[model samples]
Target: MNLFERLSGVIKEELTSLVNQSIRQEDTPEEEIERTISQMRSKVMATRIAIVRSSASQARLLKKGLVILEEELAQAEAKREALLRRISQANQRLERATRPTQTPFYKLEEKALELEAIAQAADELNWTKKINS
Candidate 1:
């Protein structure tokens, strides 16, 4: 049998033995015996109710623990996302500073700026030559 079943049988035997020992006196009246049994039954019922309430209290505590763990997991995930975003930003900044020639966009921008500076210089030379003439 399961441990709970064995434990229940043991408890039943002990309670019955105690009740029998308490009421076994030959001088005890029949009505008094009946009253004693009723009171014992009430006490047993109260004990059962207390056990159920204790189990419910434990269940509530377990549920609260689960909620706390879920909240912690969400916070950890948010931290992981933030860390990844920071790493990506840092990598982009490093690439721009150290490897501009390796990136096509930076290379094109640099070429455009150089060409604009050359055009401006040529325009200035033409303006000066016109003034001289």
Candidate 2:
């Protein structure tokens, strides 16, 4: 009876150990699944953060580029205006250079009368009498 009691005690201990090991095995898969889910959540959060930061950086760069484009547009407008003014000035100079110089009719008539009076005075002078003699 003593030997039988010892054998029964050993068998009971072995069954208990196997039951505990099976429970641990079952709980291990659940723990590993939970850990995997947590790691995935962390990766998703990190990706979202990176995307947000990249978007902000891209926005800043685009804003800077817009500013530069506006400045260039302003400069281009100023240069265009300056070129137009210069072209207008050059056209005015060209028109003036190509214009014909015209003397007034009144000035020509006055000069003709003055020449006739000088000729008449020269004919009455003794200088013409000596030349004719």
Best prediction by TM-score: 2
| Clash number for candidate 1 | 0
Q: Give TM-scores for every candidate, taking all chains together and pairing residue i with residue i.
A: 0.34, 0.35
Give Cα distance to truth, residue 25, candidate 1, Å: 75
Local accuracy by lDDT, each model: 0.63, 0.59
Q: lDDT of candidate 1? A: 0.63
**Distance (Å) between predicted and true CA of 17, model 2?**
80
Off by over 4 Å in 1: 1-55, 101-133
**What shift in Å separates residue 108 of candidate 1 from its native position after superposition?**
13
What are the per-model C-alpha RMSD values against the true structure? 27.6, 38.2
Per-residue lDDT tens digits of candidate 1, residues 8-97?
765786688678867777544444545545544544454444344445665455455445545655565566567668989999999888
Clashes of each: 0, 0
Instruction: Kindly report which residue stretches of model 2 are placed more than 4 angstroms away from their true locations once superposed.
Output: 1-55, 105-133
Between which residue pairs do clashes occur in model 2? none
